[model samples]
Target chain A: MKGTLIKTVLIGISLGLIWYTNSHLDIYNLSIVNNIGIFAILALSYNLINGVAGQFSLEPNGFVAIGAYMTAIFIIPMDTKIDMYALMDPAPVILQMQANFPIALLAGGLTSALMAFLLSVPVFRVRGDYLAIVTLGFGFIIRIFAMNSPAYTNGAMGLNDIPEFADFRWIGSITIFTFMVMIHVIYSKYGRAMKAIRDDEDAAVAMGVNTFKVKTYAFMTSAFFEGIGGGLLASFLSTIAPDQFTFLLTFYLLIIIVLGGLGSMTGTLVSAIVIGFGLEWLRFLDDNMNIFGYETGAHPGMRMVVFSILLIITMLFARRGLFGDRELSDILKSKRASKRKDA
Target chain B: MSKGILKIENITMQFGGVTAIDNLSFEVQKKEIYGLIGPNGAGKTTIFNIITGNYHPTKGEIIFGDETITGTKPNLVVQKGIARTFQNIRLFKSMSVLDNILIGFHNQSHYSYLEAIFRLPRYFGQEKKIKAEAMAILDEFDLTSFADHKATDLSYGNQRKVEIARAVATNPSLLLLDEPAAGMNPSETEDLSTIIHKIKQDFDLTILLIEHDMKFVNNMCDLVTVLDYGEKIFDGKPADAIVNEKVITAYLGDFTHA
Candidate 1:
């Protein structure tokens, strides 16, 4: 009873904090906060497959692309879509696509979920490194499809003038929802089955886990939220192109989850914030600067270089990432126990 | 005589060019503790795999409780009232002992993923019920004290007990144990034998076990089947197996008068 009260109070406090930040922060800082929220959603969902279910899949970029395109097509007005399709006339299906913001977001999620379901039949046929290779190809295939389909997607040029429906309110709420759902799953029976599959697939099969079904379920769930995250990204930026949903986006999320701790959701949350801010803060490295007395020209991708070095240092010092699969709550409980022992 | 609870009919398992089990046949009566013993590479574990649906037999069928279950998936085999343990202890290393056992009740917890994610009433109700049942199984195995400990952190004997408890939590009518006494000391082995007997009686289980311990076989099994080169060399009383001419020759090899 006391534990439940404490949790309820904590949740209330956090929600209040989100509301405060939404109302008080300026557009620049608020955009960073919204980006972090999207980051949290994407990383949390990705970890379900890569970390929790223990399937090394590299297909989030594909699913996110699908989500972004679907949501963009649905949310854009019929006239705007036709005007935006500069390469060729808009496809009849693309012109007919229309939905409210919530419906558009849901459509994005469902389409990606459907894609994930179809992909699993072939993707799950391989395991370990082969799974990674097959999924990486899947991401590539999605990008190529986007690039080739001009009538629907505008080909090389991407959709623009997307309505800014995904504000801090939307992103923040969804991020918390995603976090809560993940926690619920990690503590549920299906979650146990997932961990069982992660530990040893053969043993899980013997335990009647239906390894394929559990894995597919995890994959679809991961895709659904990743799609939504992509939708939020599209609306937040008010533009999206095939190029934006590349392996680089997936690579950033991979770095976040790895730096957070693979299987720990709390770790993912903390790492998302740290990496989100860290990336922006490191932008100074990309500008022209003087080292001592020598002036060097700006390096466009220098931020990534410094980021990689920091990751290497983190790997050397904390090989399992920030939390090493232990959640924040578990650490707190241990700390409390030690304090009591000291007393 | 009790009717057969499990029938293995002429099951042949072939992998590429190698034949693992050739025309193996066995029938385990209801509530009987049956033993499958053989030398290393003699297809004992292969037979267990075939029965548990890990390997579909290249040729034959498996019948459990009057249902033809050959070539079924491993999860379906467990759903059809068959559960098994591995030759090596394969507990989930990251999970607590309670969580490991709760996984055995995976099929039993009749709540949807939505309910679980949303924490609906059904989720809480089923989870509470299942956790209690898992704890009870642990209590029966005297593992309640280690319920929250990491399953791999348990002692070897306790780990074996936990595995058996997990298998029993699946509510299986037929239990397949692969080398349950593999690495136990004599006292641990004795305790294991006692616990196995108790569970067989308590759960009303028909057990088919693969073991190298002849004493364990004599003490626990009602009947023994001996295999040599994937062929049944002897099948009868455990006491009779030791004295059979073919069994002795199979174990010690044919002696030449010099």
Candidate 2:
């Protein structure tokens, strides 16, 4: 209990720092911090399926893209919109409502969730690598469909001039809210069913778990949050494009979950924040660093090569990842006891 | 007239060219311990699997509580008040013991997705009540002490107890336990017998168990059915079934004197 209190205090302090930084910091720093908050939400939301539910999914980027386009359609100013690739006879009636940030985010999430429900009927029966391939195909299909559907998504040129409504405070608060709700669900009875399915599907079925239903619930819920994260990203950047939500984004999210540890919520949270900031921090070295007298800037893909190598090493050495399914509370408890002994 | 809880009529399960269970018929009366004993590969487990909806019998009709539940999904069968444990311990290894039992309470739960997501007052109320019930069930098996521990971290005996406790948490009218005492020591087997008796009396459960432990089966089961090569050799009182020459030969060799 004492350890929990301390951890809560620490989280409060960190959140306070983020709030202060967002309000008082310079524009560039604020933007970087806002991006971090957006990715953090994306990572944590993806963790619901990939981590806590013990399912490998590559569809977060697809859901996020859907959210982004939905948000762009809803939140962008109608008067300022230019006809870059004007496929619509006129803008749809729902897009003219001028919704606020929260409503747009919700719309994005719900839309993505609906898509997930439609897709999961056939996809949930397949397990492991097959499931991953199916989801990856779904993500590609979403991107390709967005590119081809000139009427709805503006085709190849993509939608632009989306209104920027998500500031640092908004994204940060939503991220924290998402984290709290996810943690609660993870500890709840339904969460137990998800873990049971993850651990042993056949055993769970024998125990009377409606495996398909539970899996569908998890997939849709996770997709909803991922969509919201995507909406935030589109709003934050003031743009929506098919290229932004690609297989690379899915790969990065997978790295975040694996680095955090499969089924570890706290691990996902920590890894997201750390890797979000780490990716930004490494940008400084991209232009200047040289390895074995070879200019790194000459090879633009070197960064991802290094990143992929790091992931492979992490997998080989620490197959369970950072926390190995231990929650933050468990880690804090041991730390507190060790601290007391040292003192 | 009190109807039999489960009526298996001419259930035959075929795997490729081999028949695992050939025209097997049985009935489990309510509130009784039905023992199924057979030599290895006699298709005892296959019969259990067929009844539990794990496998669709090539040909058969299974009537549970007057409903034709033949080839129904396992989860639906469980919701119809039939629960089972595996021959091997199949507890959710990563989940806490309490959580493992709580999974059994999934179909019984009334909370909706919204309630669970938002942690509404009704959700909390149901959660608290279920936690208490799970603890009570665990207490019966002396497993309350390990409630917070992962199911896999427990000893083999404790894991077996956890599996049984989880099965009971489903509140099934008919509980099928496959080799519940497969790996227990003598003392553990005795304890399991007592636990099984207490559970049957407390929950009003009709149990059907496939057990190799003759002593445990003899002590707990009132009636026994013997099987040899997917065929029933005897079905009668435990004493009568044990004394049958075919059953003795199936267990040991064909000994003229013994």
Candidate 3:
């Protein structure tokens, strides 16, 4: 009873804080906050497959891309889409598709989930490193298909004038929702089955966990959230191109999950914030530096170089990540126990 | 003895060009602690794998409780009342002992994903019941104190016991334990022997186990099958198998007077 009360109070406080920040923060800071919230959703879902299920899949980019395109197509006005389709005539279905913001977001998520459902038939046939290779290839294939499909996707030109449906309020609430859902799952029987598969697939099978079914569910759920995140990203930017949804996006998420701790939800949440803000804060590294009166020329992509070094250093020092498969709650509980022991 | 509950007839397992088990056959009676003993790589574990449906026999059939379980998926085999432990202690690492045991009840919990996600009444009710059952199982094993500890952090004997508890949580009529006494001290092994017997009586489980420890097998098994190169060399009483010339020769080479 006490625990539930504490949790409800904490959630109330968090929602209040979000409301305050949404109204008070400037556009620049608000955008950064929104970006972090979206990434948090993406990373949490990705962790279900990569960290929680212990399936090394690299297909988030493809699903996210599908989400962005699907949402963009549904929400964009037919006239604006016709104007945007410069290379060729838009598909009849594309021009006909119309939905409100919520329905469009749902459409994006469902489409990505459908793709995941189809992909699981082939993707789950392989495990370990083979699964990683197959999914990486899948990411590449999505990008290439997007580049080639002009009628539906606008080819290399991408889409513009995406309705600004996603804001601090939507992203913030959804992030919290995603986090809570993930926690509920991690403590549920299905999550236990996934972890059993992760620890030992054969043993999990012996224990009567249908590994394939469990894996598919995890994959679909992950794709669903990734798609939603993608939809949010598209609306927030009001523009998206094939180039924006590349393997690099998946790579950034990968780094975030790894830095957070693979199987720890709290760790992923913290790392998403650190990496999200760190990426933006590190932008100054790319500009020309007048250090000690010695002007260093502006080095484009220098931020990436710094990030790589930091990742390497992190790997060298904390290989299992910040939490090492443990939650923040677990750490706190143990700390409290120790304090009582001292008392 | 009553009719056999499990029958493996002419089971052969081949990996590409290499034949791991060549025409192995055995029968385990209902509620008996059957032992499959052999030297290293003598196809003992192979038979366990074949029975559990991890690897389908190249050509043979396995009948479990009048059902042709041949080529069944591993999870389906478990659902049909067969659970197993690994030779290398394959507990779900980083999970608490209670959670690990709860996983064995995975198929038993029938709440839909929707219920689980929405925290429906059925979800809470079922989860609470399963958790209580898991605690009871832990208490039965005298592992209730360690219920919240990470399963991998327990002592080796306790880890093996936890694995057994997990398998038992599945409510299997037939339990396959691979080297249950593999790294235990004599006292721990003795404790394991008692636990196995108690489990057999309490759960009415027919146990088929693979162990290199002769003493452990001699004390625990009602029937013993000795295999050499995947061929059954002896199938009879444990004492007779120990005295059999062929079985002795298979384990220790022919005596040479020097």
Candidate 3: which stretches are off by over 4 Å? A338-343, B256-258
Instruction: Assign candidate 1 its CAPRI class.
Output: high
> How accurately is candidate 2 docked according to DockQ?
0.77
TM-score of chain B of 2: 0.95
TM-score of chain B of 3: 0.97
Runs of candidate 1 with Cα error greater than 4 angstroms are: A1-4, A125-130, A334-343
Kindly provide the TM-score of model 3 when superposed on the true structure, using C-alpha atoms.
0.96
Tens-digit lDDT string for candidate 2 (A77-127): 666554544765434663464788889899999999999999888888766
User: lDDT per residue, candidate 3, B58-103, as tens digits?
Assistant: 9999999899999998889999999899899889887889999999
The TM-scores that each candidate's chain B achieves against the reference are 0.98, 0.95, 0.97
Chain A TM-scores, candidates in order: 0.95, 0.88, 0.96
**Cα lDDT tens digits for candidate 3, A1-343:** 5866987898898898899999999999999999999999999999999999999999889999989999999999999988999999999999999998889889999999998999888878766687788779888998999899999999999999998989898899889988888887887899899889999888888899988888998999899999999999999999999999889999999999999999999999999999888989999989999999999999999998988888898799999899877789988976897687699
RMSD to true structure for each model, in Å: 1.9, 3.2, 1.8
Rank ordering of all candidates by DockQ, starting from the highest = 1, 3, 2
Model 3 pairs whose backbones collide:
none
